[model samples]
Target: MTETLTTALIEMREDDVLAAVRAATEAGTSPAGIIAGLQAGMKTIGDKYEAGEYFLSELIMSAEIFKRALAELGLDQSAAGTGTRGTVILGTVHTDIHDIGKNIVASVLSANGFKVVDLGVDVPAQRFLDAARENDARVIGLSCLLTTAFPAMRETIATFAAAGLRDQVSIIIGGGPVNADLALQLGADGAGISAQEAVILAAKAVEGGVA
Candidate 1:
């Protein structure tokens, strides 16, 4: 890992990290190495969140900064399946436009080398199914910030089952209004309480395992 880049990223200095990524890419840094640095940065942010030193706004800002820098690193989206890591389809459930948490999870997964297909906000159940099917994603990440969107989460799972894709994709739910109990009630495979937990659980879910 690039220690300097990782350290600067932990400090949440977007410009510094971007410079490091650019320099590394130009200097022949391997894609895996650059991704490791990004993942380290995400882990730092996750630590801050767990320590109550970072808020949702901070998390979202950091995610966007990393995504922009990663894009500059020449990551091949078309080669998403080239890595040993499995694919993930992430989205903010239908009617839920709050995507801060969802974006954090997606960024973390991306840094960890998981091919993430982010469906963005207000993603309907059918869209999730379509993305999962199209990408052959191993896991489906659902984020909800409102209790009203809770039904959308359940509907998504139902749609997957109806399409005979439920067993093929593990469902993970997260965000402010979500909890382990609700996740279980909704028939989800797992629930993530924080960005760190999301990364851990997502990796496991993709492997057809859980934490």
Candidate 2:
């Protein structure tokens, strides 16, 4: 049981999480090991969300605490393309300011060696295009927490199509309100049901392996 940091993250105990992180570091826990514990906690948080034991607020609180803990441990979230696996352009879609799920995915992806270009919340469709061009990202990840952002997702995919990069770029949609149906409907490469799942999707998308 990785409950030392896992439980603190699950319980959203900011102080306890930091304390446990420090304790683990002093006890010779590798950085990857520490991050894995936090990631495990996030997986449990995601499971609770799916099981209806946790709501959006709990997700939000847990994400904030998780992010803070990462920063406390000197894990830079903004250090994009710093991984060997691949690069993933990630962000919350337009009109979806709630980034509880996005934050979790970002942390997990980074820990798993995915270079993440996180564009943050309330991102416009064109921003994705610009970021993709600037970063030359092959895997584009769109996260939607609001149902209203569905249209925005459509527009984003259309933007890629309009630019003739749809075939070259693999788009992945995720977040609380997203599911496989929505992912297919939006013509996304796939739906990321979890953070680890997103990593797999990104790794595949990079090589143009997404269907």
Candidate 3:
């Protein structure tokens, strides 16, 4: 059942994924197990995207399919549950309305036991800070597909500094235009090239292991 779920997701078969998830649940598969299967599938999708075997549309499709499967399993994609390992505040910087990558990262993080407080796209710097403080989030994920949004990302990080919460949280940046060098220049702790990497980085942040 798990294999079916994973295979359906990796193949981007939305209907198959939903069916597999339902069957898995009825077969007594735990929600965590189902989520784990989906995560493994999403990891494959991310790898394919990075390898050029897939495109943006494919990535978006995979995210959508994953969301459907999660919904079938009765999992809340918006926020983490009681067993959440940690809390993360995620959003695209102001002026950047892109959120496909952000949504992928949010789903994967939630699957990995992190509570995600997704602020949605085109989010202002202050909103990010406010959500972080309100959720007591230890990790912040700033995403921007536009190079012009870099300043917004910088401003968001600066807001954290201004609020004196810089040392209390780990900030990670993502999106097409963001790289390790850019993240450093923007005062972020690190950068993730894919949603899988984001989940790993967020987990490290929760452990206070990210520099």
Following a full C-alpha superposition, what root-mean-square deviation does model 3 have from the true structure? 3.4
Return the TM-score for each candidate structure.
0.77, 0.65, 0.75
lDDT of each: 0.80, 0.79, 0.83
Candidate 2 vs. true structure, TM-score: 0.65
Worst 10 residues of 2 by lDDT: 76-85
Tens digits of lDDT, candidate 1, 1-211: 3787888878888888888887887889887787778767777887787788887666777767667766776655335222357788899999989997887777667655578889999999999999998988878899999999999999999999999988778899999988999989999988998876787787787665543
Question: Which candidate do you rate higher for TM-score, 1 or 2?
Answer: 1
lDDT of 2 by residue, 70-120 (tens): 777787644422366677888988888988788778766665457788999
Clashing pairs in 2: none
Instruction: Answer with 1 or 3, whichever has the higher lDDT.
Output: 3
- Model 2 stretches with alpha carbons more than 4 Å out: 1-82
List ranges where model 3 is wrong by over 4 Å. 43-58, 78-85, 95-114, 145-148, 194-196
Best candidate according to TM-score = 1
